[model samples]
Target: MPIDIRGSSASEIADSLRALVERGGLRPGDALPPVRTLAESLGVNRNTVSAAYRQLTIAGLVVTLGRGGTRIAGQAPVAQEGFADTVLRDVGTGNPDPSFIPDPSRALATIAGRPILYGEPVIDPDLERWAQEWMSADLEPASLRLTITSGAADAVERLLAQALTREDAVALEDPCFLASIHTVRMGGYRAVPVPVDEEGMTVDGLRAALAHGVRAIVCTPRAQNPTGASLSAQRAAALREVLGEHPYVLVIEDDHYSMLSRTDYHSLIGPEHRRWALVRSVSKFLGPDMCLAVTASDPETAQRLALRLTPGTTWVSHLLQRLAHALVTDPDARDRVDAAAEHYAARNAAFAELLTAAGIPVRAQDGLNLWVTLPVPARAVSEQLMRRGWLARTGDEFDLVPAGPSHRLRLTVHDLSDDDAGQLAADIAASVRAVA
Candidate 1:
C-alpha cells in the first residue's frame, strides 16, 4: 500500500505512518518511498519528507536502511527467562536469585499519602533527596542534574530519542546487553560494535568507533552482560582518554549492577566531557518490578531528559519512587541489599570455580551469571545441554554483529547448590566435548 500525505506537515505525515503501522498497513520490513520521491508525490519539500521519516524512525515505526531504502524496523527479540518445565534445570534465565530480593512489605508500610496529580513534581522529594546523595557520591565533582525514569532501558531510550536522529551510529559493547541491542535496533539507529574484554570495553575498539563518527556510546561499566567483565580503573582511564578527544559525543554509562557489583565504579566520563549520562538502575538490587532508575547527567542532558518525562507525559510513579526510597534509605533494608550483593558474588565465583575444575574455564568476575567459552559452537553445546535437561543461553543471541562464529554461553546458575553446580559443569564439559 502507498502512503498518501497529500496536504500533511511533517508531524502529520509521521502520525499517518504511525497509524499505518498500528493498523497493519505498514508491516515490519515494509519499505517506504524515498524521501525525494515521497516529497515530490506529496508536493512537499524533500526536507519535510526527511523530517517526517526521522520522526517515524525515532518513534521506532520505521528504519532507514541505507541503499536498501526506508523500511519498518524489525521487532526486537524478547529476553527469555527460566523455562517453565518441571524437569529442565533452568540456568539460562538471567535473573537474580529470588531469595536475594528483599521483601518490600515493611517499605510499603512506610510509604505515605496518595495526593499525586498532574502538574506535580515528577520525582518524589524523599526519593530525590536520597538519590541526589547516592548519585553524587559516585560522580566526579561537577554540576550534575538528576532525572528519574522507569528503568535503565527507559532512560536509555529517552536519552537517545532526544539526542540522535534515524540512522545515526551509536556505539555498543560487542557482546551487548539484550535490552540495549533491542532498544537501539527498534529505534532504527545504527549500532556500532565495541569489543569488550575481561577488563571491560577495549580502548582501541572505542577509538575506532569514535573515528567512524558515532553520535553516542552506551557502555556497561561493571558486570557487563554475556561476558561478566568489569572496567578496571586503568581500563576506565584509557577509555576516558579515547573519549576525551570526542567529548561532544553523548556518553551513556549504564551502571545497572551498581550496588550488586563487587567492583568499584570505574567511570568512562571525564569531568571535562560535555554530553554524558550515568544511569543506575535498582532493578538488580531492588526487584525488577520496582521499575525505577536514577540518571545522573550534565545539566543539559538532564534538562532534555526532563522534557521527555514531564509531569503528565512519562513520569515514573511517585508511589514507586517513594517505595524505592524507603528501601534504599531504611537501615535494615540497606543491609539486606548489601548482603544480597555479596551473595551473588559468592555464588557466581563458586560456580566459575566449579567450571574450572571441570576443565571448562569460565570468567565470571562479577554479576549474576558466568560467560563460559566452549571449544565448540555454543548452539551445538546448547542443544546437548537441553538433552541433559539443562537450558542455557547461547552467546550468539547477545552478539551485536551477527554472522560470526560464537563459542560462548551465558549461564545464570547462581542459585544452584554444590551438587547441582558440579553436575551441570560436568554436563557442560561433556556437551562441549561431544559437540567438538
Candidate 2:
C-alpha cells in the first residue's frame, strides 16, 4: 500500500508523516516520495516538501540519506560496552578485571559528611580542587574550568549538545567507541569517519573531515577502544598543527583509560584553541559503578556545560563525588590502582606471546582488550570459537562505515588465568585456521 501523505504546508506535511509513522502507515526503511514528486502530488512548491523532510529529520522521525533518499529511521540496537550474556567462555567483554579495581570501602568511610542541600555548590569542593590540579597539569591553568558529569559519555553528550545543533557534522574515529557513535546518532548529528592506525587518528583523515566541514571532533588520546591504539607524540603534533587552523572547532578528548594507560597523554587540543574539552573518567580504575568523570574545558565551554547541570536538579551526587575523590587520592588506593595498571599490561603481554606461539602474531597494546587481526573474516572465526565453547566480538560491530565482514577481533582476556588464557589463544588459532 502507498503512503497516503496529505498536507499543503510544511508543518502539515510533517505532522501527516509523523502520524503515518505512529500509525504504522509508513514503516522503518520505507522511503518517502521524491521532493519533486511529492510536491507535484500535493500541488505545493518543491521547497515546501524539502522543508517538511528537514523537520522530520530534525525530529529523528526520518533519516535523509543523501542520494539514497529520506526514509523512516530504523530502530537499530546500539552496541554496548560490558559483558555479553552467554554461558560460553566470554572473552569479548570490554570490561576491566574486577580483581584490579580499587576497593572503595576505606574511601567510603572518609566521604561521610553532612547531607548536601540543593543550594550547595554543584561540585564538591575537595573533588573540584583535586580535579583542578590533575587537569591543569595538561590543560592551561590560566583558562581552565572544570565540570563534573555522570561519566565520560555524559560529558561528551552534553558537550556536543552545547556546541552543535542537530545535523551538524562531527568527526569521529572510524572504528569509534560505541558510546560516541550512539551519542552522535541519537543527537541527530552527522558523523564523518576519521581512520585510526597504531598511532591513533590519522592526520590526513582528520584533514579530510575538517575539509568536509565538521564542527566537532571527538578524539581518544590513549587506549582507543577495540584497536588499543594510542596517539603518538609525532601524530599528535601533526594533528595539532592541522587543528591550529580551525581553532574554533570543538575538540573533545576522551581519555577514558587515563590512569590505566601505559603511554603518555598527547593532546589534540592546542593551547590557543578557543573551544575544547578534556574528559577523564575514573570508571576504568575505580570501577564502573562509581559513575563519575571530570571535564576540563575553556571558560566559555565550561559555562555552557554548566547550564545543563543545574544545581538542584542535575548535579552529580556529592557523596559519589567525595568517594571518588577519596579513592583516587588515598595512598593505599593509589597503590592498588598502580598495581592494577601493571596487571593489565602484564596479562595482555603474556596473552600476546601465547597468540604468537599459536601462529597468530599479535603485540600487546595499552588497553584492556586486544585487537587481533585474523586471516579470515572475524564473524566466521567468532562462529568457529562459539562451536568450540567460546564467545567473541567481531570488529565490524565497531565500524562506522559498515564495509561488510571484518578481519579483526577484539578480545578481553585480561581476567583469564594463565591456563585459561593459553587455551583461549590456542582456540583462537584453531578457529582462524578453520575459517581460513
Candidate 3:
C-alpha cells in the first residue's frame, strides 16, 4: 500500500508518515513518492505537502538525497528545543508568599550554643519534644515515629540512599517537584514516572510503576507540583490498598508545604504498610532559609534514617528546630502563618479568575501557584513575558514525559500586588494571543 496518509493538516501528514515508519512499511532507505504526486493524491495543497515533508526531514525520519527523492533515515525526529535551565521567575516556584510568614525573633533571643563535641547527638531535647508534637498532626498514627532533618529534600535523599541501589528505579510524579526528580538523577537512580491527574497520582500509573519493579516512591499527596493536584482522601485509600500488598516498597511523602497547606493530610501508606515516611518541612511557611524538616516514619525506618543522620550530621540545626517549634506553637505566629496560607490560596485563585476573565483558562486546587492553559505554546509565551521584563518558568521544564505543543503554564500568583497581577494578566493575554 502507498501508506494511508489521511489527516487534517501538515502536522497530521507528518504524523501519518511517522505512523508508516512505525508500521514497518517505511523502513530505512524506503523512498517516499514525489511531493507533488503525494500532495495531489492526498487532495492537499502542494505547500502543505512540502511543509510536512520538511518537518519529517527535520525529524530525521526522512532525508532528501538530492534529486533521489525522500527516504526514511536510520533515526527518528529530533526533539525540538527543550528546557535550558528555565529562568527563575516571579512565577512558577511554589514557595510560601513571604508577606504572611511571621518573623520569629524569640528563637534568636534564646539562641546560645557552642560547637558540639564529637559523638554528640545532633537534635535538641526541647526541639525533639516539640517536634514529636508538631509531627503528630500530619502523621496521626501512634505507631509512626518522627525524626528531624535539614529539609524535605535532604530527607528524600537519605531515604533513597538507605532503600535503593545505584540505578534502581524509583517512581515519582511525572511533573513532580524539581527537587525529587533532581534527587533521582543526582543519586544515579532511574526515574519511573507515574502520571498525575486532577486527584494526583493515577492508579494505573502506580500499577505500571509497581509492575516495572520500582522499589521506592516519592509522592506529594497534597499540593502536587506543577499541576497543583492534591490526592483525594479516597484516592489515598486506594493507593494505600495497592501499597499494602507491597510491604517492602519505601514510600516517601514530601509534604513540603505543610504549614502553608490548607488541605488535610492523606497517606498512601496503609496502617499495616511497613516502610514509609511523611516529611513535613517547615521551610515553606517559616521561610526557606529556616532549613528544617520533620521526618516522621515507622519506628524501625525512623531509626535507620537516624543512622543516616549519624554522629557528624547527627541531627538538624537545634536553633532551626527551636525556631520551628516556637513559631508553630505560638498563637500569633500560627495565625500569621495560617493567614499566609490563605493569602497564597486567595492570590492563586484570584489570578486564576483574572486569567479566566481574560479568556485564559486556569485552575489550581490549593497551592502557592496556578496552572494556566494559554492559547499557544507556553514556552513562547514565557519568552515574550521575559521581553516584557518578567521572567517566567516554562511548565515543560518540570514535566517528565514529553508533551506535544501546549499552552499550559504554571504561575506563582503569590506575592503579586493587585496592580502587578492585573498587569501580568493583561500582558499574558497579549503574549498568548501574539504567539497564537
Instruction: Give TM per candidate.
Output: 0.84, 0.92, 0.77
Q: Which residue pairs clash in candidate 1?
A: none
Off by over 4 Å in 1: 1-76, 80-87, 311-313
For model 3 the local lDDT of residue 105 reads 79
Query: In model 3, what is the error at residue 263, expressed in angstroms?
Result: 1.5
* Candidate 3 ranges beyond 4 A from true positions: 1-89, 113-117, 140-142
Tens-digit lDDT track of model 2 for 56-170: 8755688888899999998766789887778998898888888878888777888888998867788999999999999989764368989999999999999999999877999
Return the lDDT, model 3, position 318.
Answer: 66
Q: After superposition, how far is residue 310 of candidate 3 from its true place, in Å?
A: 2.3
Ranking, lDDT, top scorer first: 2, 1, 3
Q: Predictions ranked by TM-score, top down? A: 2, 1, 3
Alpha carbon lDDT of each predicted model:
0.86, 0.91, 0.79
Give the best candidate by lDDT: 2
Tens digits of per-residue lDDT for model 1, 1-436: 1665444589788877888888887788888888888888888899998888886766566777799999998776556444545577788888877787888998898787977987788889998888899888988847999899989999999999889977799999999998998898778787899999999999999999999889999999999987889999999999999888888899999999998888988999998999999999999888888889999999999999998776434688888998998888888877888998888888888888888988887766888888988888899998999999898889888997776778889888878888998899899989988977
Worst 10 residues of 3 by lDDT: 76-85
lDDT of 3: 0.79
Model 3 pairs whose backbones collide: 59-77
RMSD of each: 4.5, 2.6, 12.1
RMSD, candidate 2, Å: 2.6
Best by TM-score: 2
